[model samples]
Target: SQQGEEDPQALSIQEGENATMNCSYKTSINNLQWYRQNSGRGLVHLILIRSNEREKHSGRLRVTLDTSKKSSSLLITASRAADTASYFCARAPQGGSEKLVFGKGTKLTVNP
Candidate 1:
């Protein structure tokens, strides 16, 4: 079974605004990762936060995880048309295989 599912499914925002996407999962996780995919391109690693960590930030991105709620969220600050893409959440199961289960993803459009 899939371990993670992203919320909202889609988001549209104007440039300079912030975009937020959420994810919920079942079962324990070793870590959770957020990925972005541009149209007709492969997924790119965005950020990864471990189960022991509550939050992490990199560049214009911020991520938070709440194991108690089995949920996580990704925040993209200062929206730009270049930031428009599909964002996915993937989880690495605790003591499970190396593979990460991915959600359907949330499509974000940043208008200029």
Candidate 2:
């Protein structure tokens, strides 16, 4: 496999607290994207920080990249019950394919 799966299949946090998650993958990549999925809603594009970029932030979402370590982290500041969902990291491979192969995802449950 060209991609490595993320550890900690699930996470739970209290409302108003921050949540952090990590992902690691093997091989080279052009870009990695983070997505969020609610119970009924489809995958919503959260953020995309390229391999060369170190970090990017959006409202409550913050993403960091470490190419040397082949890993990335996501921090949600002051999470809410609305934030309860599954988060996934996907990569657009270095070469050959154009589709993003997604990880199994980390299920995040925020208690209100």
Candidate 3:
């Protein structure tokens, strides 16, 4: 499958703490993206990292990609209760279809 597998199916943390999630895939990809989804809501794009990039950051989010290992990781710094959501990793194939394959996701809960 082109979809990635996310680590830690569930995570719970206190507010203001950092949260980290990992994703591993089997095949090569063009790019990998992270998305957030609140309960009963559509996903919101968080960040994307190209195959050539080793790391990238936006706001409180940090993403790292390792093509050699076909893996990636997302880090949310100083998380808040509002950050509680399911985070998914999606990948675009190197070629062919433009469709993206997504993982089940990691459920994060931040307690105040």
Query: For model 2, what is the C-alpha lDDT against the true structure?
Result: 0.89
* Candidate 3 global CA lDDT score: 0.95
Scanning candidate 1 in windows of ten residues, the lowest lDDT window is 1-10
Model 3 lDDT per residue over 93-112, tens place: 78865799999999999999
Model 1 lDDT per residue over 1-91, tens place: 6758898999999999999999999989999999999999999999999999999999999999999999999999998999999999999
lDDT of each: 0.95, 0.89, 0.95
User: For model 3, what is the alpha-carbon lDDT of residue 6?
Assistant: 99
lDDT per residue for candidate 2 within 4-37, as digits (tens), equals 5765689998999999988898878898899999
Candidate 2, which segments miss by more than 4 Å at Cα? Answer: none
